[model samples]
Target: MSEPNVLRVEGLRVHYQTPAGPVKAVDGVSFAVRPGERFGLVGESGSGKSTIALSLLRMIKPPGRVEDGSVTLDGVELLELTDEEMRRVRLARISLVAQGAMNSLNPVKRIREQIALGLREHGAAREGRAFDTFLTELLERVGLRRGVGDMFPHELSGGMKQRVCIAMAISLEPQVIVADEPTSALDVVVQWQVIDTLRRVQSELGAAVIQIGHDMGLMAHSVERIGVMYAGKLVESAAVRDLFRAPLHPYTQLLIASLPSLDGKERLQGIAGSPPSLLNPPAGCPFHPRCPFVMDVCRTTMPPPREHRPGHFAACHLYETS
Candidate 1:
């Protein structure tokens, strides 16, 4: 039998209450991450991809709140947990590899201290030498030398700092690891190295990973399933190979087309128009303004999700009639 999902989000709606109006940051988004799955969320900036990640951990700040829906991790309702209960859940069950490694790490603390802080918080540390040995093992698991842990964050390169963050994330052996743009702002070689490290660590730890970023090419190779988000909604979701081979949604097609081809035979195409403002998103279908195949029904009524294949699904008016 197949393993059950480790994380499941249903009809999640996170909105920000601004003075001007309410911004629907994450409107009715739903997806699942199975055990040991590498799930990728891809979209343009401000598409609510990061917001969804924050909501998973109940990390939404004031003015922004998880208005509705359920986030179930290991069959527990995360939204129903109290603040203290959620705190206990954070590093022990789920951890975040935040974007911008330089900012995530403390410039004042050494790498060993930062990683040990997580272990200490979770009460996983043993006395004396045992704790030190465990810490060294964590560093080596992420491709870092044991001595590197003694150096400060400023002493390491961007990629090395990122590795430290990864090391800290898996330090607790959490079941789920959310990596938001873990490879942003790195050179091509460094990007691949970080990706490789992440893959290896996830394999070793057997943790389900949610990798959020805008680069479809990177997601294509790194994840098993891909979900395309647009204007605060999931436009399409499918296995990596199925989505790339036959994208059902126009937005998914546009995003796949935007990726540069290594063979240089295909011209890169840009999606037209800017993404809609969540404060006053378009009615019915939020992507109607930019979708070339939009119909009158698309502007008048929201399209329901349709299963185009065994595991592929999309929310588009064009698929409704198929």
Candidate 2:
């Protein structure tokens, strides 16, 4: 965590060309991930967390494009690379564990065949029994049985399917892993198992991880740092302990307050009003309409992100006054 940043993102903006004008999915968001560190992106649905993931890997398809930004991996500007160059970079250097395991895997292909895709593409594939031995080790690394190499997607449980995705993600030992909701839709036990599996493999490979999810509780103990986003903008970013202990932005505070308390003492509260429409957000801060501490400056001008405390950054008028 003390190492220099392995991946740096700055001034990122991703927009979708909808019929009702362009929807700003990501608006000038910036953050960085250090080697072998676990970073979390937590926000409500439609807050552009997933969009930032897509933009990082240069996967935003037609209709949605990374308008302006700088994504550099080890000092190489990702935005400047050619399509094929970026293609080579993926899996070999950067891999993704998609949110939906079933959707990410091919139902028609067996697990062994599917796992071979990255190895083969990256020129590390072995044939016959040698390949079987390699595949078995890969599956075992993610807490899967050796027999799982012959099973299809439907045969595995939700957690197992996700573990399979993790196995595939680490086959080539990439430098970074982007896990977009890797534990969603699973029971508590299964979620814990999958998260453990992810952490184990990440440790063995020594890869930096960017975990994107809506579960703040899950993120609290699983990561070192957290970035909070709202309505296409990063409202706050800080160390996980500091973020939970002293939330800087209003949205961050409300989000933490909304989580159910384990002691059953504090009432679980929901934030008033819904997230703004990205197609036509408010003039100043998009979160101003829902914020309780709104001010004249917040209503009229978009607050630039500033480091309020050491390594803690927030975009809000309250800090400016303090």
Q: Show model 2 residue runs off by greater than 4 Å.
A: 1-3
User: Which model scores highest in lDDT?
Assistant: 2
Q: Give candidate 1's error at residue 206 in angstroms.
A: 1.3
Q: List model 1 lDDT by residue over 1-322, tens digit each.
A: 4439999999999999999998999999989999899999998899999999899989999899999999999999999999989988997889888878557788898888877777777777666788789878988998989999799988898888898889888888899999999999988889998999999999888899999999988998899999999989998999999999999999888878877788857767998998999998998888999999988988888787768788898998887764
- Candidate 2's error at 96, in angstroms? 0.5
Residue pairs with clashing backbones, model 1: none
Write out the backbone clash pairs for model 2: none
Error of 2 at 178 (Å): 0.2
